[model samples]
Target chain A: MELGLVHYLILVAILFCIGILGLIISRNIVKILISIEILLNAVNINFAAFANFGDLDEAKGQVFAIFIMAIAAAEIALGLAILIACYNNRHSIDIEDYTSLKS
Target chain B: MEVLQFLFFGMFALVIVISALGAIFCRNIIHSIVSLVITFLSVSGIFILLNADFLAISQIIIYAVGITILLVFSLMFTTTKDDNKLWLAFAPRTILAFVVAGTLFILLMFNITNKFTDFNINPKSFITKAPKESTIELLKKQGTTPIIGKQLLTKYVLPFEILSILLLGVIIGAAVIAKKDTNEKNRASESA
Candidate 1:
């Protein structure tokens, strides 16, 4: 069967759900960051698919995806630095251990 | 006739799902990072399938190559194999997560069903159109890359400049955070 726009949307939805599951279930801080990447990719898929089929404006989605990648790179750098600092202080990367800072 | 597209979609979906599962279920953080790289590649493939070649290349280069390597290097310094735990502890938070995710999925499916019910499912108009004329030709006709380059320099120049500054700030912030203070007694020396 030919894959249509709906099929792509469904695929994106499923991938997004999996990404969300990863975000919720993974306890390792690094894994959580990776899950966030997955979620961002799911959004990218939707944007590109819409640009391809629903509209002819491919540049819009491509440009947006480029911006998303830049933001993601910045986010990863900042997050990893913070994580490293946390590890330096506590010697543990567990999210559970971060509760001491919780108010 | 369209079996190739279906196969591509199926392969992309499989890679995305398996890599995501690997990222979630793996006990080794490094392994999860590798799986995330795979997931990023698969997503890039999907972008190509959607006819966004530029985004696909950027996704692979930026995400798989740059970010994943940065994460893995950070992981190396942060935790040793001996100190790493096999699995994370589960608690009431897991239950809450399941409930929230399930509810959101149901709501999403409901919305999709309602919205797409009346839409025509035909794929011919979109599929049969040759890619050369539709995208590449149009882009060439419009001097696409140059247009984008000009916009990046002119209209969106502020955001472009701000992004460079933000990246510089992140570099400085990271250096400050990761630098060890020599004034204090180092942990390794104290332990030795």
Candidate 2:
């Protein structure tokens, strides 16, 4: 069957749900970062689909997605660096174990 | 009726889903990074489908090539190679995640169904327009990077400047966090 707009939206929905599940369930910090990427991709899918079906302002959505990717790159860089420092001091990368920053 | 479009869409969806799954489920951090690269590429395909070829190429270059390599390099330095089981305890929280995500999905479906019922399905006409030659051709017609450069320098100058400041802050923060604390510990030892 030919995929319609609804199909695309449904796919995005499922992907968003999966991303949320991964983010909440995964204890690995790197996995959490990956899940966040999945979530961002879901948002990008929605933006592109709406732009395609309803608006000629597709370029705007694409532009915003590019910004998001840039921000994500910055976040991953800073986050992984912090994780490395934490690992050096604590000898582990487990989020549960990083309780010195908690509270 | 269009075979190529159908095939492209199928392939895009398949690659996106598989790569996303691999990114989530992979035990190795490096493998997860690789899967993320694939996911970025698939999203670029979706951008192409939306007639944003410039965005597609930028996405491939920035995400797949630039960011992924940075991630791999940082991971190599930080994490141990042999110790693969890096996950923390996660049993109790997973159930909560499922419940929340399921409820959100149901709510989304309800909203979409209601909205779609009220709206008549009108196939947008602009998408049927003949595809332009390429982004390069359009850029050539419009005098390429000058327009973007002008806009960035004028209209978006504040955000542009702020972005550079943000990058500088990140670099400083990363340096501070990643710095060895041996000197401080030695001071403490001497005092003790």
Candidate 3:
């Protein structure tokens, strides 16, 4: 068999699913954040691959990927700050500690 | 050329998957972060293989350098306890998560393989763009960075500007939220 877009898609799917798994099972808020990053990276790979293989007039997918990276950076910064505040209040970063927010 | 492409793809794929798994399952948080760094690097390699030189460079600079540094700094700042086990194996949702993830993976694999069969005849035309000539030939004519720049300024100018404002807001908001206000601290201590 020849290598094609499907191979890249398959890889992205695996990464995305594992990211979900990580998000589900990790108690540490930081680990959950990392899992979210993994999910974003998987989407980025999909965008980049589409732009790479497709014969578009412009690299629209790559541009989308760039935007995604910027947004992800901003998200991480804000999220970490929130985590810091949470830590200061509760003295722990575990998601389990925040039971009030669950409902 | 085909053999070389296959070899490079295989190597990068292996490196990305292994390190990504390591990042997720490592016993130590610091080790997990290190593995994530490696995974990010290998992902950049995959971007390079896709012929997205500008994207690959941005991936390295944005993800490997900027984001990783932020993660490490946050990891250091927030948590002082040296607890190694991060996984919630006993959590009630853990089994549900596994089942959902496993089913999703299988569904994706089946659909993708089916689509691959249908797309095999002319994989290039499966998505969009007929490409009268050839994709690689066209990509070779114009540099990726300049094209991306032109597109950003012309077609995507609004989003480009919006991103700047969003970034500015995020920076200031994060600073304000993370700061220890005297009033809040006093109230918090009084309540405690």
Q: How do all models score by TM-score?
A: 0.85, 0.80, 0.90
Tell me how far candidate 1 lies from the true structure as C-alpha RMSD in angstroms.
3.9
Best by DockQ: 3
Cα lDDT for residue B114, candidate 1: 59
Candidate number of the best TM-score: 3
Residue B171, model 2, lDDT: 85
Q: Flag clash pairs in model 2.
A: none
Docking class of 3: medium
**Sort by TM-score, best first: what order?**
3, 1, 2
Model 1 residue runs over 4 Å out of place are B82-86, B115-136, B139-151, B185-192
DockQ of each: 0.54, 0.45, 0.64
* Clashing residue pairs found in predicted model 3: none
RMSD of each: 3.9, 4.3, 2.7
Model 1 Cα lDDT, one tens digit per residue, B48-161? 777676778788889999998898889888877753473544867677667767777766656655543533443333442334455667764653345446657776788878
